[model samples]
Target chain A: MTRLLGLDPGLRFTGWGVIDAIGNRLRHVADGVIATDGELPVPDRLRVLHDALVGLFSTYAPEEAAVEETYVNRNGSSTLKLGYARGVALLAPALHDIPVSEYGAMAVKRAVVGTGAATKEQVEMMVRRLLPGAVIRRADASDALAVAICHAHHRTSALKVATGTRMA
Target chain B: MTRLLGLDPGLRFTGWGVIDAIGNRLRHVADGVIATDGELPVPDRLRVLHDALVGLFSTYAPEEAAVEETYVNRNGSSTLKLGYARGVALLAPALHDIPVSEYGAMAVKRAVVGTGAATKEQVEMMVRRLLPGAVIRRADASDALAVAICHAHHRTSALKVATGTRMA
Candidate 1:
């Protein structure tokens, strides 16, 4: 079994989830958001995020890490703000020497819900169903789980292909 | 004497400068760029930035920190890229328990060059004059010194005003 971590980052709230991938099966471990005060200065807020992410990494010690790839938002300033949180999210796992992967929204939705254009509600519902008793606390957490599921599926497929090639 | 660290952040190169603020006078200490390879993954790139910032903090032990305020670029993706570096630059000092301040380009220019609309060359020239014997290795380093100079001037002015108020 390999433990995997998924992160969906935002300036106000960063959603994180951990799961154990046992071959083709997945078992949910935990999921939650790391929130920061908006009134605090940007650096202070980022420090909060950095600490929370490090805490989670030490707590779970996941073998692999995945994060949602950012899309350019319409508002330039907001995109920059999101970038700050995303940077911390990406850096935290790498700082711990865990390999990190990025998945786009479409890939995550398709992996979890079997559709690239899955709605928010659909993705949330599928995550709960796939994980079986996963108490997804928020939209961000649900999205994070979706990312983990996607990474699990991709890794499993690669393993299967490698084994088949060896046998042939 | 108060030690200050100033940062000018970019994805490819982050410029940093250290200075000693002695009452109303300023003395240059050091300046350089932290460069990262473009071929590496974003997470790896961020890890490099995070580690470098921490290394600098430990080396300088600056009592105060300042970073340049970002301007949203015309290209959204580039803005996000810069955001990642800026976030690291801002968070590094705060994580070290150093108070971080931000100054806009206009403020930095005015503090160093006596004009808000001063050109880059003018800012570089003024920074060199204000902090004698400073060897700026790059444009980015020059800009970082400008930020440090700006912070020193503002802090000195504030201190003077406080003293004046107490006397009154």
Candidate 2:
């Protein structure tokens, strides 16, 4: 079983999820949020996120890591904060030489629910339907799990082409 | 006297230069290097740079800040490191609400010596001529001064246009 870890990085909170991938089947393993205290300095808060991610990687030992692609917006400060959060998130898996795959939010939703315009709630519904028994508590965590499942499905298709085998 | 502090941020060394902008003249005030022992963890090194920059900002009380724009190459890791260093540099001035400006390397050189392709030695020579009494110990510091001088020249031109006044 190949386990995949997905991350959604934010300045206030970082969402993470793990999924067990066996052939074309993906099973939800764990998902949660890592929240840092708002009172701490930005750099210190970033350090907290970094340490927490390192702990997660050690506990789960996922084979592949995935992160949501960041986009630039009108507010320069907000964009900068996102960049800092991304830096900390990338550090976790890069330190252990795990290859990271990036996915856009729309692509994740489309892969899991078969619709590019699927809402967050719709995607969450599909994730629950597919997993059946996942203890998903937060919408953010469910989105992360969906992202992981998307990567697993995509990776399976890629492996088939590399092996010169056609999918049935 | 309006003083502009210039910064050249790097992973191993952070170079800083201060210049007094008086009318049409740019007089160099001080310059130095705050180098980290590269062996230290990146976060610890970033902390050192942050502290040093804060101390410099308070001591000099610069009215504005000018930073060199980052260059992207084929190596993704190098680009990421540059972005991290740039983030630390930007955060320092933002704490004091000082207006920050970014100048490309070629533009800095062109503003100082009338040629974008000028060598580092040529730029240093012009910087010494522009401020005869200033001491320049590091090449990085000199480069930073050139950027400050560039911003000074740009602001003077912009101010002239805003006021609709002709220069002597």
Candidate 3:
């Protein structure tokens, strides 16, 4: 069973999730947030994120990694901060030599909730139903879990087609 | 007479231009490309960009800073590299405590060439006309100068409105 990890990056908080896949079925493993408070400088915050991701990678040993692609923000400073956050997130996976995939927000939402324009609340609700017995506490955590689940769903379908197995 | 410095960043090269604002007149000071060979790693490339920008800042002592906003690519890896290039560019002005502004591609084209959808050649032609004696050696250098000229035009109009002065 291959495991996948998902990340949702932000300046102050980075959410991560891990899941194990067996054919089309996914088993949620763990999910949490690595948050840095405002007292730290940007580089220090990035360092903290790097350390947290290193710990998570060691703990979970996920086979693959994924992140949500970033977009432009009207606030230039905020966009710059987001870029820093993304750099740390990408660096962590690259250090482990894992292939990291990125999905747009719309793609993640569509894969999780069956609608490209699904609201965050709807996604969280669908994540709760889809990941049964998994106690999802944070919204960011749930979103991260949804991203991993989506990738697993996609890969499973692709594998079935490649193997000439008709998936219903 | 405040001077604005504009930068267009890339992994292998960073282009910069300086333009002075004298009342309603804009005068080009200097423009050049800091070229680095492709042998360096990403971190070294960033350090080279940072140091070159510091040298430029000290020499020009620009009153304001502006940069071209990053463009997203469909390829995730390409987008990531562009983000890194932009990060180094943003760090340069922020380190000097200069208030930096970012112009989107369309905004830059409009400010430089009188139309939002103006072609690159049109923008380059307008930049040459505005700075008749500039020694532009590369297209990227010209683009950087165009960004500077665009900001000059943008600020000139804003200054006129703020001071209730008539345009000549």
Leading candidate by DockQ: 1
> lDDT score, residue B159, model 3?
78
Q: What is the Cα-based TM-score of model 3? A: 0.55
What class would a CAPRI assessor give candidate 1's docking? Answer: high
List candidate 3 stretches off by more than 4 Å: A1-10, A13-168, B165-168
Give the winner by DockQ: 2 or 3: 2
By lDDT, who's the top model here?
Answer: 1
Per-residue alpha-carbon lDDT of candidate 2 for residues B1-168, written as tens digits (9 for 90 to 100): 799999988768878999999989888789988897789656556666767888998899999999887665545545555555666677677667677888998999888999999998899999888878988888888878888888899989888897885543
DockQ of each: 0.85, 0.07, 0.07
Q: How closely does chain A match the true chain A in each prediction, as TM-score? A: 0.97, 0.94, 0.94
Candidate 1, B41-141: lDDT as tens digits: 98899999999999998898999998999988789889999988888888899899999989999999999989999999999999999999998879998
Off by over 4 Å in 2: A1-168, B165-168
Each model's RMSD to truth, in Å?
Answer: 1.0, 10.1, 9.4
Score every model by TM-score: 0.98, 0.57, 0.55
Q: Against the unseen true structure, what C-alpha lDDT does each candidate score?
A: 0.92, 0.80, 0.79
